[model samples]
Target: MAVVKISERGSFRKEYIRWWKHPEKDIQLFDWLDENERERKTLFSPGYLRDRRNPLPYGLTKMECGLRAAAALFAGDPQRGQDYAANPRRFSMSVHDHIRSLRFKYRRFNSKIGAKVSNMAYVDIQGPLLQKIDQLMLVECPEWIRLHFHWRTDPYYNQYWPKDQPTAREKPVQANAPERQLRKSSPGLVNQKRALQASAVRVRDGQNKANSPVMELPTPRENSNSGTTQVRSSSTTQEIETLASEGGHASVIHGGATNLDGSITSIQRLELLIQLRKLDIEREDKKYAAELQRAQVEAANRHQSEKHEIMKQLADYVTGGKGSTGGSSTGRDE
Candidate 1:
């Protein structure tokens, strides 16, 4: 499982999902889900696990960028964001409704919905919508958003608020959640975090070393009188070059390369995220399988017990009949 550690900046980070990614929306929604799940314990069940609704294995298909943007946009709407934070399922269902309406509207007038908008303004909404969403989240929300956000449904987020903070929502988003709990309760998770921490630290350090600007060695100078200059090969420079070559980062650092440290951080986070998501999916699948198996076993036992009871009743009926007949026959013969 991916471990969440307090970063150098002290914000919770999970893969590409940063706590400060989409403030007033993404972070809040993530927390809402966590708290809701914790309180209601309404996570994946055997039935849901078997069904296709919101399949367990997330990121199997990356969400279309357009939809992702639209969702972000929808959430960034101060009113909508608060509503969604209050009720995720209801908000999602509303999206479903809007999608249906749009599908009907577009399908009636245009055959090429992707290229043309029929009666609408834009040709392809994929980019524009995303831009608007980005603008709403990255720029407008912090300025214009109303602080009186409240949920009509459940206030799971508000329960942990402090007495002094005059905010609708409470709690500095839980840095460590279930995975955190697992670390405390399960030795395996603790060991796993340690191993992953060590590995990421190594990659981070290696990238920093690889990306460290190559120190400018002194350029060979021409002797004014002799018109010749001898270049002394520095063993230190040779060793550095050798190390770079051995590390396979020699060419990577040249030409003002992109932040190798940032890239490594992304890679490390992504790798761990994939592992954690897959593990979570695997665990859910296993849980469903176990529950299903248990149900089947219970069913089989109940059926066997019923069959035994029925057989015993039939045997008793037969034995009683035989006894009665024998007694009558003996009486008649006597």
Candidate 2:
């Protein structure tokens, strides 16, 4: 009785097969299969619930959508949603071919095949038909591929483009086309610029703090000459020690120790740091600008060149262009 979503179709198949294979879970599997059967029949039969979320594309008819849904169910294998998303025209045509094959088989031989196996089950006046329905369903399971079906035999072969691999026409287009620059978009450039600006602002703020004045009080002098000279000498030594310590710290930032002559002041050293950071920001901006330019150029070439024309042609062909001779193949499988 579990309600299966469209995306979970493949997963349900896997679970169903796994549980059905186990002899111990026969009762559970049968009950689950019956629920699934009733659900599929109700959904695919006339007057099924219309799902707006998975609505059909602009050009596709309701019948086409229903047909594709049935094809997906009978497909019996995982059909990737990505394939349909990439190109619905190609996906629908493939589904059409599958349904055509199934319809042909249903009309030509399935009735007789079903009749041969009908005697295995008991029938009641008010119950289901006396047939091995489960076994019959297994016999009609669809294959993922048709090994012998060639494009030349198909009337609408030109419209059938492979999603997994590029065609001969597309190869040259791709080779000539420039590579996509995923990281070089406008948003990335703007983000880098903002970050660089913030860094520059921080560097400027640090420089301003380095230039701020610091108030100092003269060391207290002794009343006697001898004491005064001693105090003066001590104060000079302490000042020299403090300047040396400050210079040592500045050396780490400036890439070299301050000169003995004290040519570079703290303010000048901070200015140098600010200038270096500005240069780094400018360099980054130029690099990002160049990358963005290249990305724009690549986009223009891809959309305005021969590649665009080829894509348009393929799309028109798939949708059945006006006065177009190309149509579905009339031939049948042997």
Candidate 3:
């Protein structure tokens, strides 16, 4: 067997009729109905809903009943309908009061209600007002209302208005193609390049001077041929010799010899002494050869004396004398 699932339809129409006839089905409904009836009588009169006081049944069609119910729900109390018909401010004040009450009740709890309350409060009145305004604009006055009412005055209303007008500040215009190239070749850029080159040239010239060789006193060639390799003077050479004999051992030598004349003399003196060292080594080798020969001759004489003494002892032993047997010997007559 195939079972069909079905849902019972909820009749907003029936709900509306029930609320209208009884006006006390739900506690919220009862309170709202009593409050609405009080407000309606205060704004209108007790006879407002009745056709006659004596006999005729107070008749209302289903559509009227629905409309009244909807108006009461939107206004937040039934009495607000009478106030709305009387004056728009009364209806607006009622809406504000209802929103304030909802906000207060929802704010008491620290739960999800706090977040929903603001939106619920806003929509409760704002939704109906917007719908009514839209209906009026569409059916009643389209152009007149648009021209007179600056809908943008209200932040909420401006959101729904047509967006055609331009904003106050427009975007800047981009430079034309030729203008861009012109900017690159401007005189200002040309001057900047020239300034940079001049600064670089000055820097290069300064560094070159720092590394250049300094001039010194003239040598023998400068005085004689004026072109050949310059030989230092005798006095300068003597000063160089003195500095070289000092053995490059002094830390202050460089400080004292910074002058161009002193530096040249010191360098030449060092070179001459190195040459003298090579010559001195060869001379010492030649000088020590005769002493070495004398020492070798003296060593050979000592060795010969030792060998003669050993031979004499052997001769004595072979002759079988008492001397051979280790006794002292005296001289004998031939």
Scored by TM-score, the top model is 1
Note each model's CA RMSD in angstroms: 26.6, 39.6, 52.2
User: What C-alpha lDDT, on a 0 to 100 scale, does residue 162 get in candidate 2?
Assistant: 35
User: What ordering of candidates by lDDT runs from best to worst?
Assistant: 1, 2, 3
Alpha-carbon lDDT, every model: 0.34, 0.33, 0.31
Rank candidates, TM-score, best first. Answer: 1, 2, 3
TM-score of each: 0.26, 0.19, 0.16
- List, residue by residue over 133-232, the lDDT tens digit for candidate 1: 2232222122111111221111222222334643222322332242243223322324434545554465557665343221111122344443221122
Error of 1 at 4 (Å): 32
When 1 and 2 are scored with lDDT, the better candidate is 1
lDDT of 2 by residue, 1-334 (tens): 1111133555442111121122112222222323443332222222212442343324334445533553353334233344444444444343334334433443332233222221111111011121122122322321101110111112122122334454332232221111111111112223334543555566567754333221111122345688875675466445434433333121112212233475432222222333334455557768989999999999999878878899889988877763343332323321
Q: What is the lDDT of candidate 3?
A: 0.31
lDDT of 2: 0.33
In candidate 3 the C-alpha lDDT for residue 159 amounts to 29
The top-ranked prediction according to lDDT is 1
